[model samples]
Target: MKQTVQLAGLSCQNCVKHTTAAFSKLEGVESVTIDLDQQLAQVTTDTAYQVQDYQEVLGPLPYKVESVL
Candidate 1:
Protein backbone atom coordinates (compact mmCIF):
# COMPACT_ATOMS: atom_id res chain seq x y z
CA MET A 1 0.00 0.00 0.00
CA LYS A 2 0.99 3.58 -0.54
CA GLN A 3 0.28 6.52 1.72
CA THR A 4 0.69 10.22 1.38
CA VAL A 5 1.27 11.84 4.74
CA GLN A 6 0.87 15.54 5.27
CA LEU A 7 3.38 16.87 7.77
CA ALA A 8 4.17 19.91 9.87
CA GLY A 9 7.49 21.42 11.01
CA LEU A 10 9.43 20.41 7.93
CA SER A 11 11.65 23.28 6.84
CA CYS A 12 14.80 21.96 5.28
CA GLN A 13 16.52 19.05 3.58
CA ASN A 14 17.64 17.88 7.00
CA CYS A 15 14.03 17.68 8.08
CA VAL A 16 13.28 15.64 4.96
CA LYS A 17 16.17 13.31 5.75
CA HIS A 18 14.98 12.77 9.29
CA THR A 19 11.39 12.18 8.22
CA THR A 20 12.52 9.75 5.52
CA ALA A 21 14.65 7.87 8.02
CA ALA A 22 11.87 7.70 10.57
CA PHE A 23 9.32 6.26 8.15
CA SER A 24 11.85 4.00 6.50
CA LYS A 25 12.48 2.32 9.84
CA LEU A 26 8.92 1.10 10.15
CA GLU A 27 8.71 -2.70 9.82
CA GLY A 28 6.42 -2.86 6.81
CA VAL A 29 7.56 0.28 5.07
CA GLU A 30 9.31 -0.43 1.81
CA SER A 31 10.32 3.15 0.97
CA VAL A 32 9.90 6.78 1.97
CA THR A 33 10.06 9.95 -0.06
CA ILE A 34 9.84 13.31 1.64
CA ASP A 35 9.10 16.59 -0.12
CA LEU A 36 10.36 19.49 1.92
CA ASP A 37 8.56 22.05 -0.18
CA GLN A 38 5.22 20.36 0.25
CA GLN A 39 5.88 19.21 3.78
CA LEU A 40 4.66 15.74 3.09
CA ALA A 41 5.88 12.17 2.75
CA GLN A 42 5.02 9.38 0.34
CA VAL A 43 5.41 6.02 2.02
CA THR A 44 5.17 2.61 0.43
CA THR A 45 4.50 -0.32 2.72
CA ASP A 46 3.97 -4.02 2.34
CA THR A 47 1.56 -4.35 5.25
CA ALA A 48 -1.50 -2.62 6.53
CA TYR A 49 -0.71 0.36 8.74
CA GLN A 50 -2.80 3.20 10.09
CA VAL A 51 -2.27 6.90 10.59
CA GLN A 52 -1.91 6.44 14.33
CA ASP A 53 0.84 3.95 13.77
CA TYR A 54 2.75 6.43 11.67
CA GLN A 55 2.17 9.18 14.19
CA GLU A 56 3.47 7.04 17.01
CA VAL A 57 6.76 6.47 15.26
CA LEU A 58 7.22 10.22 14.87
CA GLY A 59 6.17 11.03 18.42
CA PRO A 60 9.71 11.58 19.62
CA LEU A 61 10.56 13.89 16.79
CA PRO A 62 9.85 17.60 16.35
CA TYR A 63 7.75 16.86 13.28
CA LYS A 64 4.07 15.94 13.39
CA VAL A 65 1.94 13.92 11.04
CA GLU A 66 -0.93 16.22 10.11
CA SER A 67 -2.91 13.74 8.05
CA VAL A 68 -2.59 10.58 5.99
CA LEU A 69 -4.35 9.41 2.86
Candidate 2:
Protein backbone atom coordinates (compact mmCIF):
# COMPACT_ATOMS: atom_id res chain seq x y z
CA MET A 1 0.00 0.00 0.00
CA LYS A 2 1.09 3.56 -0.61
CA GLN A 3 0.15 6.85 1.01
CA THR A 4 0.96 10.47 0.50
CA VAL A 5 0.82 12.48 3.69
CA GLN A 6 0.54 16.24 3.72
CA LEU A 7 2.27 17.75 6.73
CA ALA A 8 2.92 21.04 8.46
CA GLY A 9 6.02 22.41 10.20
CA LEU A 10 8.44 20.66 7.89
CA SER A 11 10.96 23.11 6.46
CA CYS A 12 14.34 21.41 6.16
CA GLN A 13 16.25 18.35 5.15
CA ASN A 14 16.68 17.48 8.79
CA CYS A 15 12.92 17.28 9.08
CA VAL A 16 12.88 14.94 6.13
CA LYS A 17 15.48 12.71 7.72
CA HIS A 18 13.60 12.56 10.96
CA THR A 19 10.29 11.83 9.29
CA THR A 20 11.87 9.18 7.08
CA ALA A 21 13.41 7.44 10.06
CA ALA A 22 10.18 7.41 11.96
CA PHE A 23 8.12 6.04 9.07
CA SER A 24 10.70 3.43 8.21
CA LYS A 25 10.31 2.00 11.67
CA LEU A 26 6.64 1.26 11.20
CA GLU A 27 5.78 -2.44 11.07
CA GLY A 28 4.52 -2.50 7.48
CA VAL A 29 6.23 0.51 6.03
CA GLU A 30 8.65 -0.36 3.28
CA SER A 31 9.97 3.09 2.47
CA VAL A 32 9.43 6.81 2.95
CA THR A 33 10.19 9.72 0.64
CA ILE A 34 9.62 13.22 1.87
CA ASP A 35 9.41 16.23 -0.42
CA LEU A 36 10.39 19.23 1.59
CA ASP A 37 9.17 21.63 -1.08
CA GLN A 38 5.60 20.42 -0.89
CA GLN A 39 5.79 19.07 2.65
CA LEU A 40 4.59 15.73 1.48
CA ALA A 41 5.59 12.27 2.66
CA GLN A 42 5.16 9.43 0.19
CA VAL A 43 5.04 6.16 2.07
CA THR A 44 5.06 2.59 0.80
CA THR A 45 3.76 -0.04 3.15
CA ASP A 46 3.22 -3.79 3.02
CA THR A 47 0.32 -3.98 5.40
CA ALA A 48 -2.87 -2.12 6.14
CA TYR A 49 -2.54 1.27 7.81
CA GLN A 50 -4.73 4.32 8.24
CA VAL A 51 -4.24 8.03 7.73
CA GLN A 52 -4.70 8.68 11.44
CA ASP A 53 -2.14 5.99 12.14
CA TYR A 54 0.42 8.03 10.29
CA GLN A 55 -0.64 11.16 12.09
CA GLU A 56 -0.27 9.47 15.45
CA VAL A 57 3.25 8.42 14.57
CA LEU A 58 4.19 12.04 14.09
CA GLY A 59 2.36 13.42 17.07
CA PRO A 60 5.41 13.54 19.30
CA LEU A 61 7.33 15.63 16.83
CA PRO A 62 7.37 19.40 16.43
CA TYR A 63 5.03 18.95 13.50
CA LYS A 64 1.45 18.21 12.69
CA VAL A 65 -0.33 16.39 9.89
CA GLU A 66 -2.55 18.49 7.71
CA SER A 67 -4.10 15.52 5.94
CA VAL A 68 -3.38 12.29 4.12
CA LEU A 69 -3.67 12.37 0.37
Candidate 2 lowest-lDDT run of ten: 47-56
lDDT of 1 by residue, 1-69 (tens): 888998999888888887788888899899998888898788999876677887788768898888888
Model 1 scores worst on lDDT over the 10 consecutive residues at 47-56
Total clashing pairs for each candidate: 0, 0
lDDT of 2: 0.82
Superposing every Cα of model 2 onto the true structure, what RMSD results? Answer: 1.4
| Best-performing candidate as measured by lDDT | 1
lDDT for each residue of candidate 2 in 1-69, tens digit (9 for 90 to 100) = 788888889889998888888778789888899999998889998866666787677768887777776
On TM-score, the leading prediction is 1
TM-scores for all predictions = 0.88, 0.85
User: Any runs in candidate 1 off by more than 4 Å, and if so which?
Assistant: none
Cα miss at 15, model 1 (Å)?
0.7
